[model samples]
Target: MSQVFKGCCAAFLYGVLLATSLGGLPASAGEGGLYRKAGGIEAYIGFVPAEITQGHAATQADKPMHDGVPRGHHQYHLVAAVFESDSGARISDAMVTAQVSGLALSGPRKAMDPMTIAGTTTYGAYFELPGADLYTIVLTIKRAGATKPVTLKFTYDHRNP
Candidate 1:
């Protein structure tokens, strides 16, 4: 093959490899599964079973329900962190609210508690899952210096569990 043709082919292969590698990286806005970016801020959310948050008990029946959560329902812990979109600086002053709902039932929107964990400020709240159903979680964030609130929605299907 000619030298110029060989050079072009190598460049093409390199470009393909680069593109494929980059595609695997997280997106700027929705990089991680529970990440979203809006109104110049990035938010990360995590959900954990009540057992993990409250500690494991000898039996599932021994687990206590979080305040205000009804009995016979399983509680899920929600944790969130906000960051500046451009600088990636942790944002601790933003007001965060989580609205949890399901196709069968919708709960009231509640304010999440803000706390510092391991030097990082995070917001947390507990939601109840009555049974196997599809649930929708919507987070509304109001950050300082931002005119509008950022809203992000995530869905969870607990049909099997």
Candidate 2:
């Protein structure tokens, strides 16, 4: 019991130190928050379209090593994270959706289900590209606390060379 208590205390202190270093920004203001600041969801979607295309092409042509495995011709995965705000450490239940155009892909636009974590939940959707090209991605989020739904648009150009 004492060891557990000590571990918890250390974690608490570490969190405090980290928060202080980060201007007291909540941990949720981490990656997802960064994504939001960089044009929010729309900007991220735009970046992904190209990333997926180029990534697929590169994998096919080079047959290069990736993700600790060999490359193959396959559809790229579209992962997304919907957060309330930079300080919103917890991901509330929200209706999140994603869609892509200019690519041939099929999968559930929304995540399997809303996931709850320590203080946040991320909705991730998986998709496969039909062909290599620039694709448009749209994301929409709705939560009870939010007065309006947050929507984002972006494009990606996948190229693997």
Question: Can you write out model 2's per-residue Cα lDDT over 11-129, one digit (the tens) per residue?
Answer: 45533432243323343443432244332222122122222322221123344212212235444434444533545444446676777677554434544234222333444334556
- Candidate lDDT (C-alpha), each: 0.64, 0.44
TM-score of each: 0.65, 0.46
- Writing each residue's lDDT as its tens digit, candidate 1 over 54-158 gives 321111245332343333448776777777778877778888999888885777688886655444566767778777887777889887777888998777676
Residue 141 in candidate 1 has what lDDT? 88
Off by over 4 Å in 2: 1-34, 37-73, 86-90, 103-112, 116-120
**What value of lDDT does candidate 1 attain over all alpha carbons?**
0.64
- Where does candidate 2 have its weakest 10-residue lDDT segment? 39-48
Q: Pick the candidate with the highest lDDT.
A: 1
